[model samples]
Target: MKSNLVHKVVGSQYPLWRTVLLIIVLILGLGQTYVSTHFYLLYNKANSQHHDVHHEYYISVTKPINTVASMSNPNANGFTNAEIKNIQNQDFVDRVGAFNPTLFRIVIEPPKGMGHQDFRTLLFLESLPNAFLDVDTTNFKWKEGDKYVPAIIPRSYLDLYNFGFAQSQGMPQVTEGMIKLFVFNLEVKGPKGSHKLQGKVVGFSDRINTLLTPESFVNWGNETLGSVSKSELPEQLLLKLKNPLSSDIGSFFEENQYEISKSDGAKAALTNLINYSSFYVWLNGIIVCALSIIILLLVVYLSIASSKTEIMQLFFLGYGVGKIALPFQKIAAIKLLMAAFISLPIGAVVAGMIVKNSAQLVPFNSAGFQLQLLLVFGALVLLICALVVLLIKVRIKRLSV
Candidate 1:
């Protein structure tokens, strides 16, 4: 048959060394690209859950208290309206929220039947705009005459009492569920005289350290019970950044002698580093893929050169270019297909190793990840094969002429 004749003549010219080299590059290219893409996806998932980097993009900025200077002017550390306006004009800042602190004295009486009836602690409460809250509490709003107040305390506060203070004092540790169920009283006192407001824990925040109520509650409390006749200016500002990793953010904060949370800065730095590394890895994979494609073209040209006489004679004998190029195209396709198959298992094993070593720092669904990788790598190989097949036909036509 004509097919059999074409296969025997062209297939014999495939150099063994060139075939092996092509396979190695293809596997290296496909496997590295898959790994880099997987890393990027995993990082995005982790950021979404933790909001440590890239997710919320909010940080609390405050001026350092100067003890000696504060004695001369108590409001020296507080942000002036002009200072806030200057920060709002910065290119990196999307918006800023001021912390509304309670200007009246607050006494938190413990819930009844907790073994210590006389237990009371002096507590400071602050609030930000509802949009600036890291934790969502639907019940955390208050208006004038509302006796019930919902409070959000930091998780670190509970941890400190449960693991440190309670243990040292031989007191019972309370869980979040237990604490939420208990009702407490906020005894607020100022020039307007003392009043008791029923308070309940609505949620716990991981991002903020201060106890938070609703902004409306803080504003109303300041107006009604504040020692001063007017509300105090904010001592701290919460900034929503356009990009947390921007160099201008650090420089601006540093120049103004403002302090940012160390944890937020470190997390953003780590995320930026990972992003740059992933891009370089992805670029390298593309280079390897390009090299492999170049090698494939070289193999086709060399094979055709060696078989130039036979190809010309076949063309003279009424054999079309497609018939002569079929065997070469099939060999290239098979090599690419084999590389794809081999890369899958290699990629899977490497991915498994990463998931195992990551130790739940990032969540992974092995089955879903593998399926995505397969679809993506398959498309890449298909495109490469299509290009190779077309190039093979053109090469054969030129040699035959």
Candidate 2:
């Protein structure tokens, strides 16, 4: 008697109105997820494009020419630690590091026969922390009697030397590759003593316009041959900004009376703007997801309740709550799977269209979306299915006896 009633009750459920309503709700929920994900993905793609083109570039901080120091310190020409601390707290600034300037004079002894008479040149050697270096410092080992000082020079400095200095002196213009090809020797004479050092042009900086040495080598060299005339404060600083193009950033520097020079022209600023805008799309997507989940809960409840008589009959016939909930769980799972499958391609197509329209502005591959998005979509589908199944089980347990 109970088995026939259970089958009849289960088979009799034809809640056409509830089905129609839930189908509409599912479409809206899926649409929300797609819109949110697509917007954020566009921003990600744009930012990636900027990085690929300007990977070797950065912006620099400078003091106004002929501007006297606000405070009376020897390193007044550059920013002080207090000012730097404030700058680091800003959202527009991405990275910040400094160069340690030598307090005393440096006289270099170039290799014999290769150098023409510029040995007494007062050279300035600055040290930046190892973290900021982009090149491989694996061979930058400095030891007693074997001082092989790996060096990084500004590309502009090399260009000036090759074009202006070499032209005036009637020397051949040397390419960047050629400088790294040769091993060179140098002698540095300080107030304490003179030491022989090997110099190799390992890399170039597009951001900082200074001769850079590893921080380890600088700490050791300063202790050994440094003069007592100067302190440890840096004269110039290099800034890595997150959004150099922001109006607030530009205004902040101008108000502080600081100078800004960018190696990547105006590209960094534009990329930051796109990031900010895309973030809003992500937030809207979140709102849509919240609404969709609510709708899903209501839809699951109605579907299960419509078949309540059959479910209760099964329970009285010694059916487990899990078994009674299984059919409703299956329905919810199927709907969720359908929603995800339909939403993902639609989102991808929309994103591709946008990318296509913006091809001139932000160049991307012809393939529209990233594989990571597909993984995230799969996770979303599973999560929704699991939640709906749990919802059905809970309702089944509550309704029994």
Best by lDDT: 1
Q: Which residue segments of model 2 deviate by more than 4 Å?
A: 1-21, 31-75, 78-97, 102-124, 141-149, 155-177, 183-198, 206-209, 214-233, 238-287, 304-320, 354-375
Pairs that clash in candidate 2 = 94-241, 94-242, 95-240, 245-269
> What are the TM-scores, per candidate, against the unseen true structure?
0.89, 0.61
Q: Write down the lDDT of every candidate, Cα atoms only.
A: 0.79, 0.68
CA shift of 392, model 2, Å: 1.6
Task: For model 2, state the Cα shift of residue 215 in Å.
Answer: 5.4
Mark the regions of model 1 whose C-alpha exceeds 4 Å error after superposition. Answer: 45-54, 228-231, 308-321, 364-367, 394-401
User: Candidate 2: lDDT of 343?
Assistant: 70
Strongest candidate by TM-score: 1
